[model samples]
Target chain A: AQSVSQHNHHVILSEAASLELGCNYSYGGTVNLFWYVQYPGQHLQLLLKYFSGDPLVKGIKGFEAEFIKSKFSFNLRKPSVQWSDTAEYFCAVANSGYSTLTFGKGTMLLVSP
Target chain B: DVKVTQSSRYLVKRTGEKVFLECVQDMDHENMFWYRQDPGLGLRLIYFSYDVKMKEKGDIPEGYSVSREKKERFSLILESASTNQTSMYLCASSLFVRTGRFGQPQHFGDGTRLSIL
Candidate 1:
């Protein structure tokens, strides 16, 4: 079965710290990747997505993700963290020709001011 | 802006009671989905509908049923609510794309936090 894995369950960092959240998918076939963030008391919003294109995808709020097919990983990154960036991040994968997304266990990031 | 609206922000029910959770999408999307968000579980899909009167079971649909009577409405039914069912339920909608292509990203609603006593 296809699955997504987020290695970090919880992370804490200070303001301006670099961020990297690991994500890996098990499917070997073509896939679409997505990163979603949910703020406190807010709904989930798309951070970025990877289709067939440049491996580096940039998203809102200075967030980006790189899809490395050989490693089967799509990891999210940010150069500087803000207090407002404290939220839960989820990595999802959908097989080509499918509409359903399989999500990994989210990582909760707390940016300390 | 695409808007997906869940009927209730919070709900409390008794065990064995039948429960109904309603979702409406203003985007006229072709796909609507129901998912439960739990701690450590991220999001588990319960049911999804591709068109009116068409529904498909998702990864975790054993205890849930779905109804899509209209294009903009998708309802999830809990035949017998249980205490273990207490969790946040999210509704989302997205446009369908052709095979081998990436579909439109899903838009989510402010989830309904359902608690069973």
Candidate 2:
């Protein structure tokens, strides 16, 4: 069984503040990672994903994440956040051989204008 | 871009009623999934179908059922609706293309906010 954990339950940041949301997954074998973001009253959209490649992967909306294999972590990062960046983010993991993805609880981020 | 569409954006049903939620994907995706989203709980997969008429139980499949009669449509059924089942239901689809080390990602619908009173 695979599971994901997001350390930050909620986060607040001012405009132009650097943002980093911690995500870690528990899976012994090779796994795929994904980050999804849902805006208020909108559908969940893919922020980015990592299957196999350069540990660091870039995503839409100026977001990026690094897959640290040793630490079992894939943390999302942005150099600076805008008020429009406020949204709920979820981290998900799927085993390489499986299509089912297990998602973490989620992290809510608020960017102050 | 792929378009996954849920039949309803919002629904209200009484407890014990048999509820049906429909989902359709415009793209000819090989895989479709059903998930429930709750506050602080993220999204939990209830069922997934890899092909037409094929279904697989996900992390949480109890108290719920699913039907994939056609390749483009998947339905989630609540045999006996309960208040605990009230949550946002999402439908997603993905291509089952295993191109070597590459993997296919999923595209989601707007979601149905179902309420079981």
Candidate 3:
């Protein structure tokens, strides 16, 4: 059974502050990683994904994630976050070639201006 | 735009009632999935269908069943709705890749918030 863990349940930051959300998974085999965001009153949307090749993957809205296989971690980061970046972020994992995704408990981010 | 449309945005039902949640996708995706989202539980998959008559149980499928009679529509059924089953349900769809080497992100609907009393 594969599971994803997000260390942060809630995070509060001022505008223009840097952001990093920790995500770790329990899987020994090859895996595909993803970060999804849910804005208030909106459905979940893909933020970024890591399949192969580059460990650092850049996604929409100035979001990026790094796949660190050794640590079994894929952490999302932003150099500076805006008030509009506040949302619920989820980390997900899937086995190679499998479409079923295991998602972690989401992290709620509140950016204050 | 890829569109996944759920039949209802909010529903209220009673215990022991049979409930049906409908989902339709216009992207012609090959995979459709139903998930229940709770505050602390995130999103747990209930059922998925890869093809028009092929369905698979997901993480939490004990109290639910699925129907995919058509390519674009996938339905989730709760035979006897319980008070504990009240939660937000989301429908998603994605393209089926033969190789499965690359990851395909699922597109989601606005979600149906069901309340069982």
Q: lDDT: which candidate is best?
A: 1
TM-score attained by model 2: 0.96
Prediction 3 global C-alpha lDDT: 0.94
Q: How much DockQ does model 2 earn? A: 0.55
Q: i-RMS, every candidate?
A: 1.4, 2.4, 1.7
What candidate 2 keeps of the native contacts, as a fraction, is: 0.46
Q: Number of the top candidate by TM-score?
A: 1
Candidate 1 lDDT by residue in tens digits, A1-113:
78999999999999999999999999888888899999999999999999879999999999999999999999999999999999999999988777889999999999999
Q: Put down candidate 3 lDDT per residue, A46-103, tens digits, no spaces.
A: 9999878999999999999999999999999999999999999999998876778889
Off by over 4 Å in 3: B101-103
DockQ of each: 0.71, 0.55, 0.65
Write the candidate numbers in order of decreasing lDDT. 1, 3, 2
True contacts kept of 3: 0.57
lDDT of 3 by residue, B54-79 (tens): 99999999999999999999999999
The per-candidate TM-score of the B chain, in the order shown, comes to 0.96, 0.95, 0.97
DockQ for candidate 1: 0.71
